[model samples]
Target: MSAVASETKTRQLPYVVAITEGVREVLKEQANAFVAGEDVAGAGSVYGYYRGLLDEFGADRIYDTPISEKGIIGLGVGAAAAGLRPVLDIMFMDFIGECMDEIANQMAKMRFMFGGSATLPITVLTMAGAGANLAAQHSQSLEAWLAHLPGLKVVMPATPYDAKGLIIAAARDDNPVFVVLNKMSLAMMGDVPEGPYEVPIGKANVVRTGKNYTIVTLGRMLGQALDAAKQLAELGIDAEVIDARSVQPFDTEAVIKSVEKTHRAMVVHEAVRFGGFGAEIAAQIQEHAFDYLDAPVARVGAPFSPVPFSPALEKVYVPNAERIVVVAREQLGI
Candidate 1:
C-alpha cells in the first residue's frame, strides 16, 4: 500500500463487490478451488455476495447444495482433505449451531488428528452483526463462539479493502478459517486494489492514532469507536483506534504497545458485554500492559440478551458513539 498507488486508485467498490471480486480472482487462479452452498449459485445468495460467481465459474465449479449446514461443512471438510480448496458458504454465522459437530470436530481437527498429513484448506464464508432487523437468528456476531475453538482461524474484516485482501489470505491458508463479514457495513464503498492481495493474518491495523487513549475494536464497531474518538478530540482528548481484524490470532503486541503509549484502553464491539469477545481482549491487555494503565480497561457493548427485533431497541442494544463516549469518560473519570 504505497502513496502513489493508493492516490492513483481508480475504483471504489461497495463492500460486497470486493468479496465477489476476490472470489472471482481466486477461482481464476486456482483450478482446485470452488464455492459450495445453498443458493450461492446463480443470484440466490442472501446478501447477493455471490451474484456473478456462477456465470464466471460455470455450473460445475459453482454448484448449489441441499439447505443443510451439516452437509455444507461436511462437503468442505471432505473436499479439503481430498486436496481441493472449498469455500463453504454459511449464509449466516448464527446457523453455525446447526452443524457444530462437523465444524468443531471434523473441519477444525482433521489436520491435527491426521498428524499434519491432512490439510483442510476450508474457508467458511458467513455473515454476522446485529442490524437489518433480521432478529436474533438471522443477525448476530458469533466470532467469540468460533474463536473459542482451537485449530480454527477466525477473521472479521471491517473495510472493503481488508474484505478483499483477507479473503485471499484465508483461502490460501491450510487451517479452517471463518470469514465473518459484517452485514452492517456491506454497502460501504472504499478504494480497493484491482488484483488480489494479502493482508497478513494475526495482525492489527491502527486505523487512527493519538496519545491520550486507545480504542480497540473491529467490524461495524470500529466505525462507532472512530466516531467517538473524533468527538473525544473536541474536548482535548487524543485517542488511538486499533482494529483487531482477526480475533483468534489477535495482534496482542499492537494493543499492548498502544496501551503503553496512551496508558488507558477501551474495547468495544456490537456483541453483548457479558462474556463477549471484548472480555478476552481486555484480559489480555491487563496481563501484558497492566503497569501502564492509568485506569481500569473499559468495555462497551450491548446488554447480555438476544438481539432485539425492534429497530429502536436494537439501536440501544448495540454499542454506539454516545455509549462509547460515556464509557470512555467514565474510564478516565472525566
Candidate 2:
C-alpha cells in the first residue's frame, strides 16, 4: 500500500488526536497557516491538543501569547487581514467576553465592512460547556452569543470525524470561523479518516433517523441525545437525532423537515436554558413546523445558574442522558 493508503488504514483515534492531526495537516498544507494563544506553543494548549506542533512547526509558526484574550484575537485578526491564516486559542469560551469587540466588531465584520476587499481567514478555537467542574467562568457555553453575529461562521463539531474535517475547512476558508470544541469531547475516541477532509459549513448531519420525534443537538450534548433516543425507543418512542454542527449558518431546512416528519421536536444543549441555542432552535421550529407539530417544542439544557465547583453539583447542573430522555418523553407525551 502507498503511504496515504497506509495512514488511512490506521485505527481510529480520539477527538484530541484528530484535532492535533488537523492542525498538523493545516500547517503542512498552508505556508501562511500559524497558531497563537496562551500555553499553545510550549505548553501545547490547555488540553494538550497542540502537543507536538511547536516541535514540528517551530516557535515562529506555533507562537505563545500573553494571558490576554483581546490581544490574542486582535493579533489573529490583524494577521488574517494581512493575508495570513491565523488560528487563535482562547483558553475557555467564556473569555470571549474580553475580546467581544475584536471578534464581533472587528474579525466578524471586517470582510463585509470592507466591501469584500479583505478576507479575514481566522479561526478561533476554544473549549466550551460545563462537565469538567471548572466552575462558572470556565464551563459556560456561549456559542449562542457568537451565532447571533451576522458575519462570522460558527462551527461546533460533535464527533471526532467532523471535528477534524471541520477544523481543516475552517482554517482554509477565507472568512472568519469560530470553532468551538467541547472540553469533555477532547478525549473521546472514534473513527476518523486519515486524509485531509472537509465537512462543509452550515450543513447538518442526521445522526439517526426515526419517525416519532426529532432531537436536535450540538457539541457534547449530541452523545446524550443519542443515548436518550435509545431509552426512548425502549419506551416505544422513536426519536431522530440531528447534529446541528454549525450554528451561525444553521441548517434550518433540515430541522424543519425533521420536525415536520416527526411532528414533535426537542432541542438540547449544554448551555443555560434561557438565551441558549435551544431557544433559537425552538423558535425556528415553531415558525416553520408549527402546523405539523403534534406537541409543543421542548428544550433540555443547563439550569439558569452558575456551574458549581463541586463534582456532585456540577453533574446536577449539566444536562445528561436522563434529562434528555425525560424531556423527549415529555415532548412526545409518553
Candidate 3:
C-alpha cells in the first residue's frame, strides 16, 4: 500500500478532504479498485478533491482520462464488469447527459441483465448544485434525474461524515451507486471518524428533533433546513429535520414516522421546485401519512427556471433558509 493509503488521520477535515480519505481507504483495501476521471491526476480533479491521491497511489491507481464523461463512465462500467471495482469521477453532474446510456443502461442494469451472475460495483462520484456560478450547463442539481432510473442507488451527502461514509459504502457495494456530492457542501466541515465506516444507504438522518413539523431534505438544503429549525424554535414551533441521504432507496418509513408525530411536513431541495424530486417525497408523505396531517405538506425549492449565471440572479435562484422558514410559517397559518 502507498504511504498515503497506509496512514490514517483522525483530525477533522473539510468535506472534500474527507471524501479523498474515503477514496484512499477504498483503494487500499480493494486492490481491484481504481479511480478514473477527467483531469483527476493532472489537475487534482476539477474540484481539487483528489489533490494528493495521485502522488500517493501513483498514476496507475489514481489517474486522469479524456475530457469525456462517456469515456470515463464507460471505463467504470467495463472495468466493474470484469471483476474490477472502478469509481468514475464525473466532474459535474450536469455532464451526466453525455453518458446516459453507459450510466442508465449499462452500469445500472449490468448485474441484473447478467442474471445476478456479475457484481458491477461502479461508483460514479459527481458534483451537484448551483452555488458556484458555473452557468446552467455546469451548475445543476440533477439527483432527481438519476434517482428516476432503476437499478441505481443514489446518495447525496450533505456533511463531511456522510460524504466519507456514503462514498466508502458506494465503493464497496456490489451495485452501481451515484455519489452526488454537492459543490456548496464541499467546504462544509464536520467531525469524521478516523477508521473505515459507513452511514448505510437507504436511511434517513434526523439531524434535529421537534414535534410540530418535519422538514425532509437532502444535500445542501439539509443545512438550510437545520438553520430554519433553530429560527422556528423561537416561534414556539418545533421542526424535525430529516436528511434524505439516499434518494433512490428512500427511507419513506422514517419520514412517515416523523410526520405521524408532527402531523405536518415540508419538503425542500435546491432543485427546481416544479417537477423536482421533492414532489415525490411530498406525494409519498401525504399518501402514507395523510390521516395524521393538519395541513398540506409544503415544499421549498428553486424557482421554475434555468439556474442563472449572474451572481445576483443565482442568489435568488437557489432556495435558502429564509424561504423554508416562511413556508413553515405559512403551513402553521402564522
Candidate 4:
C-alpha cells in the first residue's frame, strides 16, 4: 500500500463576507435561485453584503426591483410558488410590515392551503436592531412578530459561520425562511470553513458552557451575552451562553438542558421588553425547566419605546454587555 496525502484549507472572515460567499455559491449552484430587492443588484444591498453579485450573476439573476416592499414580496411568493428559489431583500426587518399580507397570507399559507402540493422556497434577508443610530423604523427587532406566524421559518445567525450555513439551509428548505441579520454582526470577523454548508433551521447552539446561570440570546445579543459571561467569570459566576439561532423552531431541548444544569436563566435580546422574543423564551423555560430552576427566569431587553436617532440615546436604548452582567447577577442572587 502507498501513503496518500490529504489537503486542508483554512480562512477567516466576517459574517457579511461569509454571506456574500454563500449568495455567490447559491447563484452558481442553482439556476432557479434568483436575487431581487431595491438596490440589491447594482448597489449590492444597503449594507454592501451583496456587493459584486450583480456583476457576477448578471442582471437577470441578480435583479434590482423598484422601491415597493409589497411588490417585491409578492413577486417572491409567486416565483417561489412556480418553482423558483428566490432570495428577496427588504433592506430593514421593520419594513416587513409593509408586505405582511403578501408574506403571511400568500407565501406562508399557500403550501398548506394547497394540501402540501406546492413548495415555496423563499428566503427573505433583512437587517434589524439599534446600534448604528438609524432611527426608529430601521432599528426595530421584529423577529418575534414573524416567529409567531405559522408555516414560516425564522433564523437569526450569531456568527459569520452560522450566517453562511443558515442562509444555505434556508435556500434549500421548502418553507418560507426569514433571515434577520444584525447590522453589528455584518462586519464582525470570525472563522468560516470553505465550501457549501447548511445549518439546519430550528436548532440552538450553546456558544459557551457554564454551570452558574444560563443566558439565552440571539443575533447580535449573543456577542454581548458572551462578553457578559466573561465579565461574570471574574466575579465567580460561570454563566452559560445559548444562542437561539432559530426563533421559530426554537431549540427548547437545549435550553431546558442548560437551565437544568445552571438552575437559573436570563433571556436577553435587543428587542423591546414588552412582547419581545425574550418573553417567549422565558415562558418556555418556565414551562419545561420550572422544576429545575432555583429562581424565576429573568429577561433583559430594550425599553418599550422607539429607538432614538441620537447616538448617545441609542447607546442607552440597546442592550449591552454591562446590562447583561447586571441582569445575570440579579437572577443569580449574587
RMSD of each: 1.6, 2.5, 3.4, 3.3
Better of 1 and 2 by TM-score: 1
Candidates' C-alpha lDDT: 0.88, 0.89, 0.88, 0.89
Which residue pairs clash in candidate 3? none
Model 3, span 173-234: residue lDDT tens? 88899999988888887877787877788998998989888999978899999889999999
Tens digit of per-residue lDDT, candidate 2, span 210-309? 9888999978889998899899999988889999999989999999999889998899988889999889999999998889998889999889998889
- The residue-level lDDT of candidate 1 at 134 comes to 90
List residue ranges in candidate 3 displaced over 4 A.
Answer: 1-10
lDDT, model 3: 0.88
lDDT of 1 by residue, 1-334 (tens): 3222554454799999998877887788788999999789976487898887888779878878889999999999988889999988999889999999999998888778889999888888899988789998988888888888889999888988888878888898888988899998889998888876777778998999899799999677888999999999987789999999999899999999999999999999888788888999999999999999999999998898999999998888888899999998888878
Give the TM-score of each candidate: 0.97, 0.96, 0.95, 0.96
Ranking according to lDDT, highest score first: 2, 4, 3, 1
Model 4, 231-333: lDDT tens per residue? 9999998989999999998999999999999998999999998999888899999999889989998899999999999999999899999998887777676
Displacement of residue 112 (Cα, Å) in model 4 is 1.6
Off by over 4 Å in 2: 1-7
Each model's backbone clash number? 0, 0, 0, 0
